[model samples]
Target: MARRARGTSAGLDRHRIATAAVALVDRDGLERFGVRRLADELGVDPMSIYHHVKGKAALLDAASEAVLHEVEIGAAEASDDWAEIARRTAHGYRAVACRHPRVFPLVVVRARTSPVTVAAVERLVTAMRAAGLPDRVVADTPGVLFGFLNGHLLARTGEGPEVPAPVGEFDAAAHPTTAALAPLLSDVGSVAEFDRLLDTVLAGIRVSAASG
Candidate 1:
């Protein structure tokens, strides 16, 4: 059994606690996570977590911030096109979420005020503004993009229902359309598929903005 480490003042900081919490979530499902458990993992008391985070919700937010900070927006900016930047950002987030499915919900709902998240949003807003999007659009684009990325990742990981396997009998009978679409659905797991969809969405957004 792993025992909590001794020494109250072990130089354990809030960032370290939050990082440990994120690691805990990555290893175990969020439903199994608690401050006490995380403290145990960190070899500290539950109260130690409070010294870093206010409560469960705050810990979750910090966990999410930690995950988002893992994204390398600077490295993803190989292309100068705003649409490309957005697509790369989406892909980066999707990759992170896929790597940490237990933390997906936290990523979607964590408060936007965390410094890492705020910096990400600022970077995104600046990109959108440079792309000729209006100030309001720039402000709202992060939410829109984040929602899309979250929904896409959730759908891809089979996080919900296992789409019933294609049935040859049912397919030959009344559900020809769905049967035909089954193969298409099967191909949707590739990164290429996501990139294509992202391109299409960004194109539509560009058109809508130009028209409006």
Candidate 2:
């Protein structure tokens, strides 16, 4: 319910505008959001937003950063196992995206050069370094981990139709393997399955490093 200044516009800041925009997106679907809508939400004229942001694209970038910033990586205290920490961090991101499916795509595609995003990446890198990962590995792991998490969440959320509708009960007569695995795929609550896959991936990374 916080409203922008009515008479005075001089107090408006970019952060405040970005925060309002994010709130607007959260309340309404991204497709329904626009500068004018955001301006109305902030109790300011649409032109006032232009003073702080170049346009909608700029505002979208800011909105993406605002959502990403909402992800809390938690205390830096070491876990008993570094791999578990990585898994937990990945799950944390997945959970956030799941809670905000409409906002997740923007976060995934936003420019990585933004200061807020850079800070978050740096924190992850620092944590990886502390967990005994080499600098090169630390630098690359976050990108890979995030990519997987984003893809997994987007797929899980049914953002797009991945599987075609069965003409009639999957037709096991034509394809044996797919039909055999159909039951497994139908299990919607697969968080445990995803966690197991995550551990496998982490183990593979460790093995690859040892081999090299």
Top TM-score model: 1
Error of 1 at 2 (Å): 7.4
lDDT of 1: 0.73
The residue pairs in collision within model 2 are none
RMSD score of candidate 2 (Å): 4.3
Q: Write the per-residue lDDT of candidate 1 for residues 106-190, one digit (tens) a residue.
A: 8776745666557766766777787788776666677777677767776665355454232323634577777777666564657
Candidate 1 segments exceeding 4 Å error: 1-8, 76-78, 131-140, 158-175
* TM-score, cand. 1 vs. native: 0.79
Per-model clash counts, in order, read 1, 0
Task: List candidate 2 stretches off by more than 4 Å.
Answer: 1-7, 113-139, 158-173, 186-190
Tens-place lDDT per residue, model 2, 46-131, is: 88889889999999998888777777556523554556667767776767676777777788777456664566566666666776
The true-versus-predicted C-alpha distance at residue 191 of model 2, in Å, is 3.3
